[model samples]
Target: MSRTSRTRLRLVGALTGALLAVVAADPAAQAHCDDPPTLADLAQRHGRYFGSATDNPELTDTAYTKILGSEFDMITPGNGMKWYATEPQQGVFDWTAGDAIVDLARAHHQKVRAHTLVWHSQLPGWLTGKEWTADALRAVLKKHIQTEVRHYRGKVYSWDVVNEAFNEDGTYRETVFYKTLGPGYIADALRWAHQADPKAKLYLNDYNIEAVGPKSDAYYGLAKELKAQGVPLDGVGLQAHLALQYGYPTTLEDNLRRFARLGLDTALTEVDVRMLLPATEEKLAQQADWYRDMTEACLAVRRCVGITIWDHNVG
Candidate 1:
């Protein structure tokens, strides 16, 4: 069998038990793709990184850990590296959870894609409890970004410096950062993170921006503006959280191409195709096709880095 056919068969096997049973019926199928090429392997062949988000709790499960270690070339902590977990109290940092994952990735010879230095959600209670002057909030934001980035400097491959900053209609989300620090906070946060870790790639990540529309247009405009201003921005991350019910973003490849044209690396970060309740065989088949299509899309673009599943198992 051809490598491409084997890849398709393994992808089917990984997604559906029924498909796996069918493949098992043929000894040649098992021998050809016995140890299927992991997403990481296929991505690496195209000079990209393939990864997934994992929580610390799942790390304790041996089966889960084994799959994570062997099957991926990169890893992102789902929540351990967030502001609430890392710096629950102001000026005091706890590296326990994030460190554990980083160490695991190291043991597995995998790169770490540190998530979310600055985000509207998962912030510490101390930060959200009070109203503050622009100056005070700016200082707080700067400290958080710098401290977090510096702690993980040289260890992580990239950082989602800012996440979900814009809304569906290309308007800025009125988070505390925007409300207090103004729209320039995005640029400010990116600069601060770069200052802390000059080597790590910085990204602005968001969802609903997979197609060439308002939300994506906002990012394209902002990315160009930032680059012109000599901002230390490196990439844009698309949280391709698709649902079979909602359908796939057909213009996803074109959208990624536009970002690459801006001299920015693009990635399908936090990807998952979820469907309602009990999944049918047809839904599973559709889901598998979506996964294959996304991988092919990334491979087609030179600057497209890789795809990271939101979690290990797709439900």
Candidate 2:
């Protein structure tokens, strides 16, 4: 292989290691950084990036924008690209929200992780208002996925093609697409997305899959099946929305390694160490430790590409 290819492979193996804790001890939400070596700065040294999710509304606030643009290299559109916002009315597309955030990211020289092409929630009324035959639903689903993917084709770095497809128990979610189109909808969604934008990395994004459990096992089985069939799937998004009450899932590293063995990149996609309202110092310290542990696990895996924090605010 050429030198360029070798370097590229090295980066691919070197772990972009998305540290969602881009919100850190330096106070991620704080307007100005009094300290040198920002999280993005450090991550850049290792061919990695830390990211935060920002909505269209948050762009105008100078304080938020200051931290957002300067701290994180990868920006995730929190609600702009979801089904309800992008295509509120059937065939009547609105790019106002999604485009604004993307434009902001571009001005700052940051890449975009376009969220959620297909998901159960946040769908428009046209889609969930009434029932339809399998063929009609499939057509609608395809048009939505392809149109949105094509519009953002060259702009985005990755697309969360299918989001939250399984329940906590590893059962297929009986979503509109699933109930009508059945389990094959996921493979079809990934395939259609690849056709629209072959270069964009496709991912199956979900929560409660940060560890080796029923939900993640469901994804593992599906990923194996898709890879075997030569479907265009690139990675899995583990929304590591950890809670202080439930305790951290200690099996996360092993879980990431298993996905790496599948030849797929993994990410702590929508991470936040949530806790009860009475934020105690003890709990806060534990949260910080949890974030650190999670980052170390992803860094340990070669195929772990990136992480995006669910919320950008710091305590």
The digit string of per-residue lDDT tens for model 1 on 69-169 reads 87788998888888999889988999999999999999999999898888889889999999989999889889988998999999999999999999999
- Regions of model 2 farther than 4 Å from truth: 1-35
lDDT of 2 by residue, 76-153 (tens): 898899999989998889989999988999999999999989998888989899998999989988999999999998
TM-score, every prediction: 0.89, 0.88
Pick the TM-score winner: 1
Q: TM-score for candidate 2, please give it.
A: 0.88
Error of 2 at 18 (Å): 12
Give the C-alpha lDDT of model 2. Answer: 0.81
* Local lDDT at 227 for model 2: 100
**Segments of candidate 1 deviating more than 4 angstroms:** 1-36
